[model samples]
Target: MKKLIAIIPLLALCACWYSFTLKPYPDIDTVFVDSFANETDRFELPSAITEGLIGELHSGSILKLATRERAHSVLSGTVTHFGSEAYTYTAGEEPLDFRVTVRARVRFERAGADSPFWDYTVEGFATYPMDESTKSESQAIDEAVSMLISRIMDRLRTG
Candidate 1:
């Protein structure tokens, strides 16, 4: 009986710290994700990143997707880098694997605000075998983009 009574208080305390939903931005409920500007040679990155972000926003309840005219905040970014380099080499110095990396400069701001609430850079990478039959560069790029989306989501959640 004593242990049960003690657990009751502890359970109540734990419940107080629990949240049913995420409120990423307490003051903003809807957001407009702008088409990312591509600065890298990879011309597809802008649309890919933008589409990935939209899919993420749709999957999560943290924020509602809105048009710029109706949005309370804006999320914008620029794809600054995209490249691949040898990650693993054979005994003879032949490339066995490569790492594809993507980087973006992102900002989150309130609608009509002169300054953003947060602005920073996020990067993601993925490795693939050199053999195109097993895994292709396109697959690695997709993985890197997924990782990038996850990092962006993390930033939004924490900020």
Candidate 2:
């Protein structure tokens, strides 16, 4: 009974030592994400990234999705580069795996602001086997897109 009482106080103390709140963008409660501009030859990248971001925002509790007219902030980006290269090769020089990379220039700004508060370049990549036994090129691209979205989310939450 005495040990339990002691642990109770210790647990309460530990709980008080840590607290979490998602107020990363304190000034902005709602955000509008725009369709990313595709500078790469891949025509589907912009829409894919844009839709992925919207889906993330819609599912997350940190930021509410809003229409452009009702948003406190706007997020836009340009898909600057997309490419796939050989990642691994067998002893006979046969391709074993490939790495797909995607890069974007992202901007986050207050609504109607003249300049963005956050402007940065973000990159994401994923590797896939040549055999498609595990993952295919399209799946690798989707994984890369998820990685890119995760980085963007980290930036929003941290900055």
Candidate 3:
């Protein structure tokens, strides 16, 4: 009977953890994110990458921090790989058609005694007609990143 009583406490302690709890997209107190580390030998990556992500997080209203050190979560990432083939004509071809792919990833770290650590990754891509202008291509990348972050937040809400 004493052993059974002791085991009861153990079982309760084990149950305290939640592997699949629908944690409300953690109300991030603050988040610090790392910029994309260039890994491609091709074009130079944009500098606004970090700023854009910061803007996304701000828009999402997930977390706010006066400084990176004060953030409860830290976000960082490396430009794993990026490349794209001409979906249609390469360039200077009549009725030019092409697709530019921007692949980037970000991860988040949260510190909490009662909350489980969480990591989120997001990627996005956009395609437009040729002659859409470089700005458009750039916009596509930002949009993709934005979409990815949104999805991550959505996942947090559900899981």
On TM-score, the candidate that comes out on top is: 1
Compose the digit string of candidate 1's lDDT tens values, residues 1-159: 999999999998788755644565688999999999999999998899999999999997588899999999999999999999999999999999999999999999999999998999999899989987678999999999999989998888878
- RMSD (CA, Å), each prediction: 4.4, 5.8, 7.0
Ranking by TM-score: 1, 2, 3
Candidate 1 ranges with C-alpha deviation above 4 Å:
1-21
Clashes of each: 0, 0, 1
Residue range with the least summed lDDT across 10 consecutive positions in model 1: 16-25
Weakest 10 consecutive residues of candidate 3 by summed lDDT: 111-120
- In the range 1-159, model 3's lDDT, one tens digit per residue, is 999999998887777755543354456667676666766663444344566666766775545643666777766666555555456664566555445555555555674334445544455555655677654666655565556556655553454
Per-candidate TM equals 0.85, 0.83, 0.58
Clashing pairs in 3: 32-75
C-alpha local distance difference test of each model = 0.92, 0.91, 0.58
Give the distance in Å from residue 93's predicted Cα in candidate 1 to where it truly belongs. 1.2
Per-residue error for 113 in candidate 2, Å, reads: 1.2
| Maximum-lDDT candidate | 1
What is the full ranking by lDDT, best candidate first?
A: 1, 2, 3
Residue 116 C-alpha lDDT in model 2: 89
Show pairs that collide, candidate 2: none
68-120 per-residue lDDT for model 2 (tens digits): 99999999999999999999999999999999999999999999999888999
